[model samples]
Target: MKTKYWTIVVLALLTAMMSVAPASAKPVTVKGKVTAKEDGSVIIGCSVLIKGTRNGTLTDTDGKYAISANTGDTLVFSYIGCITQEKTVKSAKLNVVLQESPEALKESMVTGYTVGESVEDVSSEEIRIMYVPVRQELPSEEYNEIVENGFMKVKDTPLSTFSIDVDAAAYGNMRRYLNKGQLPPADAVRTEELINYFSYDYAKPTGDAPVKITTEVGACPWNPVHRLVRIGLKAREIPTENLPVSNLVFLIDVSGSMYGAERLDLVKSSLKLLVNNLRDKDRVAIVVYSGAAGERLPSTSGSDKQKIKDAIDELEAGGSTAGGAGIELAYKIARKNFVPGGNNRIILCTDGDFNVGISSGKALEKLIEKERETGVFLTVLGYGMGNYKDGKMQVLAEKGNGNHAYIDNLQEANRVLVNEFGATMHTVAKDVKLQVEFNPAQVQAYRLIGYESRLLQDEDFNNDAKDAGEMGAGHTVTAFYEVIPAGVESDYAGKVDELKYQKPEKTVPVSLSKELLTVKLRYKQPDGDSSKRIEITLADDKANKVSVDFHFASAVAMFGQLLRDSDYKGTATYDKIISLAKTGLGKDAKGYKREFIRLVEIAKGLDKE
Candidate 1:
């Protein structure tokens, strides 16, 4: 009877355990490789996630990932610039070849010049007019820096500091991807640049400083729990006649990679337009690099436009790249003809492939940083795609106290070189840095929208030796920060335990009780070493005012956040972004704002697919 009772107890316990367990409780390790279906090439850094769970992992450089899941559990594979896919785990090995999503492939063949069909299929005259080829295009291998800004507690981290970035390359590159019917890589959608690309109407400064500061705060468009803060820095506009004489060196990359008309031919045409805009008081030199660097045209007065045009037209693409040698030689030429108080600059045009020597971006940065002390600026004009090295170009421009632009077509070229000539070539402020201190009493946490690569250590803000971005005349730089109001719970918010050894002080202060945040800016005059400081305080007011520019910039910020799939993009969607952008389509003389609205609409349609 005792043995029978014991057997019954064991049987009952087993029955309960079996009934409670999941139907497919046993888990097996699933392994897979994610490759491009078309080329069978392994995709690096693709995301692999278990369905209905937070468990996920990224593919290694070899595009392989292993995750533990039960039979019938779904697995998802996703990557930027590619379509997302899902599979149920039936067996242990579930390799996947991700086909380019219809959305990514849909608009890719639409080369902005023509609406439909390949350039080769078009009439000969039409093909000649567009200057595009019939050859199949390859995916862009361009690299961009990635930086994610996380929410910071005002008490633990009071100060937010970063270098000011005026480069608008990201904006144009994004346009290229959109036109091709594909979403850009997450790294390619920089919020700050997208916001700063368009001009904003801000009050000019009446003081000694070359830049005026503007600030506005309002309820965030995407997140009701958060508020938006806009900081605008506008450089004083200078008349073209009063601008300094320019000493320009045109550095052209003639490597075989540039043989395509979209590369070398387009560059030549763009340079001609710039040559035509040159003043007789200015000087121009031409340098070409292809396996070796050499002078294409000796320093010639800008008055000799024909000579410059001739040299530009004669450029041919062949041989390997010697970009480092070309850069050094161009700088040497510019220095030899350097004029005091003049706009001395080297304008480097390339796809940014530097193969021969000193090719690494870090080494190139050190070289450019060392050369910039000579008071010469650099202008990086990126041309072509697929092989464009945007990261290297950004580093060179930032370190050399200059600017960067991406030229996709003649229209874009004109926009950068002609429409904004003074702003592109003239530098009014150097090493500009911004630091914001938020009041913990009113704010729970804050995250900068963009400029991840431009983030600087708090101590670096006041350091004169550290390099920052340069501001050009009439150029406006804008940045956005999202703030979570006090009492709001956010995933991005941090929790800290009470200190054992120290006493907790009051959250509010008498002096700064009513203040929202203090914005501090430090910058050096175009040629000065020491820095000048500017401070402005924002009040914590219930009534918030929003401007068209502010709304428009906010829309752009949302667009970037969505592209990057940021965790902080609360309640953001393409339709909402489109609506916000539509509100600001007023007085868009250049149609840039309208263009943004159209892009948003396109993205909306694509997202649905």
Candidate 2:
């Protein structure tokens, strides 16, 4: 009986060994490639999971993925830029591709910024900020810097983007005056400096609508020291039928300077395009400027589109620029035909090189200082090359309570007019300024990135009459601050005497508000510019999803920060920027955002010189 039992045990052991053979070879192999449906970018970091098994692998550097799974198991490939995908393993090798995700728009790119202490904690009240862009490194001190104004035409697109790039940089030798604990240079502080110094006022938007503030801040991809920041605020696009028809006027500058394919000619063609798109209810007027300005055409409705087109066509570049005369006449014509609540505006199309009366930027600004009281908003459309006056245009947009745009070609005209129509005309808020009184206990020393030209005297704020930039319907404004905690301090800027006599300010906490910045908007109806002010605060902490807006804004702000030559831009370049942007690229429905990343890449490549 013992011998028979031993024989049965040996047979059982042989059966167990035969059963373990199948388990030794983990035979489920998985492989696939991940790509986007639109631009065909390889989807990296995508995970491939073998359903019902404990096996998973990520896509390789090339967006091709591999894993091991058993037959009849499901394979899942998941990534950030594309929709999650799944495939059933019918064969040993499984192939997978990803589609673009539709939910990217609702995502935010920026995380929250570490804020600094409130003003009360600081020892100084008089804060002087010096704005500086990264200057190209010169092998020698006197390399002879070159400043030029040029235009760029996109591939297959008629639009030409204007640029006034500076080789903006400074060396230890450049600031000889700033030696031994000296301050920054004055030439570095440009006209755009003071304008960019103070944060403009704005009104906080409500509900699910997003406020878009898009800007580029970097050494001109073409010219290093010359930083370029183009701000595009896209509010929720409103249907044209809901908004009132604009009672428009084309204030064309037929000055001697306005002669060229890039100037008067482009303006004429751009205006003709507008004439064709006018609504029946819209009224039109024309004002031309030369050595003196004149009313080229009186107000007329779109029923006479051909008449306006003919007048626009009749415009010929001649004489010196008499912008002051044109401004006065344009206002007069607008007043005579002003319609309450109608979109009444005189679009100033020029090269911004005003040599006539009130010709200089300050002079032209003062000239229209009182005219804004008439309630007719201004839209300064800059044209021409060589003498492209960005300074004059910025000032007019600020004082006249309007917006400014540089038009390089016809495609740009459509982008400014057709693509960003409501933003071009509709004023949702005006005189927008940003004010952040950080809780000193929570923050320390903070630095605001960019806006070197937008800083303001604390007193300049809350002064209702002070002029500021305007915001369009559905527009969003974004700014960034790199905070250095109060407990710990570094010598970033020059220390001054105000640090001696200053006492820290302390204030009691009131109701938590959503206003991250107190947006004080002062605007008049399209025709009634006596002006009105609306103040709202934007907050971004718990109990307020306000942080949500801050997230998107922060990402953009960080991008701007990464672009500028900030002392803290450690490893913060285009590669990281694309990564962060890819991570937070929210609902990118129209692919404008995808194009933005592409632009970043292209600009990186274009500016490689």
Relative to the unseen true structure, what is the C-alpha lDDT of residue 125 in candidate 1, on a scale of 0 to 100? 13
- Each candidate structure's TM-score, on Cα atoms with residue i matched to residue i, is 0.78, 0.56
Off by over 4 Å in 2: 1-238, 485-564, 588-591
Cα lDDT tens digits for candidate 1, 1-609: 999999999999999999988777568988888888888877654667777775666554356778777888888776544677899988899899987653542223232121111111111010000112222344656677686898888877889999999899888878776666678788777778888888888778768998888998999988876889999999978887788999999999999988765688768867776777788999999999989999999889989988888888788999999998999999999999999999999999998999998788888988898899899899999888778888888888988899888876555666777778888999999999999999887888899989898999999999999999998889899998899887888777867778999987756644637688999999999989999999998776856678888888888999989988888888899888988888877687655686677677777777777
Q: What tens-digit string does per-residue lDDT give for candidate 2 at 467-542? A: 6566665444444444333344345322435456676454443544422223333343333335544443333332
Candidate topping TM-score? 1
Give the Å shift of residue 140 in candidate 2. 24
Q: lDDT of model 2 at residue 599?
A: 38
> What C-alpha RMSD separates each model from the true structure?
18.9, 22.9
By summed lDDT, the worst window of 10 consecutive residues in model 1 runs over 121-130
**lDDT, residue 192, candidate 2:** 29
lDDT for each candidate structure: 0.80, 0.51
What TM-score number comes out for model 1? 0.78
